[model samples]
Target: EAGVVQSPRYKIIEKKQPVAFWCNPISGHNTLYWYLQNLGQGPELLIRYENEEAVDDSQLPKDRFSAERLKGVDSTLKIQPAELGDSAVYLCASSLGAGGETQYFGPGTRLLVL
Candidate 1:
């Protein structure tokens, strides 16, 4: 089975510019989560989706970041007016969501800001 898919694998943008990242979760998984990983730090939850419903997004920066799962399958995350500090790895994970199943992660989208 194909694991999560993310693109460009890397990105370079200037501060204050808008950028977007895409994610395709593992097939048959019902829970999807987006996370931000700063250098030397563990991934922190940005948002989570249970099918098409966004069940958790309390950690997302509402002022500049937005995400969606239109079909309850694939997802997209957007950062508008991104700041220099926003340069980090955006990871996408998925799990069966049954009794603390392990979440599988993608290679991650690496963003660089000038």
Candidate 2:
């Protein structure tokens, strides 16, 4: 089976521009996560989805960021009017369930906001 799928591995845009990232998690996985990693920092969970429901999203900036997992399969994350501080790597990961199992990660989407 496939691991995970992400598109546009890299993106560059000026501040105030909108950017979006897409992810398709591993098949049969029931838990999906979106994380943000700044340079030299560990990945921080921005949101977590159990199937099609967002179970954890306290860390996600609601004003300019939005995410959705459709039909419990694929997911998309968007940042509108992005800021320079948003420059980072957006990582997508998935696990079998919400049991703290090993998670498979995708080749993150790197974004640079000038």
lDDT of 1 by residue, 48-104 (tens): 999989998999999999999999998999999999999999999998883588899
The global C-alpha lDDT for each of the candidates, from Candidate 1 onward, is: 0.93, 0.95
lDDT of 2 by residue, 31-95 (tens): 99999999999999999999999999999999999999989999999999899999999999999
Clashing pairs in 1: none
Identify the runs in model 1 with alpha carbons over 4 angstroms from their true place: none
- Cα deviation of 85, candidate 1, in Å: 0.5
Q: What are the candidates' C-alpha RMSDs?
A: 0.9, 0.7
Whole-model lDDT, candidate 1?
0.93
- The C-alpha local distance difference test score for the whole of candidate 2 amounts to 0.95
